[model samples]
Target: MIDTDRTAAITAVLDSLADAWARGDGDAYGAHFTEDATYITFVGTRYQGRDDIAGSHNTLFAKFLKDTKLAHEVLDVRFLGADAAVVTTRGDTYKGEHPKKLTKVQTYTFVRQDGHWLVAAFHNTQRKPLMEAISFRFAPETKPKAWPAQLLDSVS
Candidate 1:
């Protein structure tokens, strides 16, 4: 059974996390994650435990990410059980220096602990461009041949 109340709570957690990131508040951002949480950045760097996640983010927020603005939207949330849920979010980061928008899809595994929802695991990956995303969904047999030779061979 899905609990709308729990889902709203989980969404609030994610919203708080994004707000903290935008404000460069590492402590507040880390508060949303559990003590043993695992965070994987879009660039594939893994941070284990809340302390490490907070520490690394603190450094970045003070330096490279100081002026970064973040916008996040909850794409979906699915309950695994009474105490567990999986959430998907779309995030866009804007920086004046970096004109190109950095968009990513973030998946979070949330678990209810001590009467509160906390992020247990998080993974962020870059979002594919519109055309690339659509093309990637094509069935293997329906995929376009990249080379002329391959096309000729397939026709024969």
Candidate 2:
């Protein structure tokens, strides 16, 4: 089980990483990851190793991401063991004169190495609400919709 103190430390690392991205500091952003970490962008492009992550982010920050600010909400953190954890978060990027174009769910896997927590694998994917895509609607006064058993049974 992960102690409260250890959880806090891991949270701090994630917060710092977001802060660095908001500041357009790629070097600082990548510092929270391990040397052999794997990072996947929202578009599914993958960057391997700390150097690649930092380098790719540096180029992005210098261009389209120059004026962007990162906003993140940590949804959950679960410990895999004493030295490993998985964190789930929702994040948005804001830039001047532009609407919030990207809303992503990020999963970060962290491992304790040499007494410090570092991201081992990071994956970001766009958030799409399935309810909206379908014609289903729910209101406070309306009864809850029942799922079709066939659909659930098929998946099972």
For this target, which candidate reaches the highest TM-score against the unseen true structure? 1
lDDT of 2 at 138: 43
TM-score of each: 0.78, 0.78
Work out how many backbone clashes candidate 2 has. 0
List the lowest-lDDT window of 10 residues for candidate 1.
147-156
In model 2, what is the error at residue 15, expressed in angstroms?
A: 1.2
Model 1, 1-156: lDDT tens per residue?
557899899988877887898899888888888999999999999999999888888899999899686777776788997899998776767765433433677889999999999999999998555544355456445444542232223232
What lDDT does each candidate get?
0.79, 0.78
lDDT of 2 by residue, 2-30 (tens): 47887899989978987898889999988
Residue 53's lDDT within candidate 1 is 87
Off by over 4 Å in 2: 96-102, 130-156
Task: Provide the clashing-pair count of each candidate structure.
Answer: 0, 0
Query: Each model's RMSD to truth, in Å?
Result: 8.3, 7.4
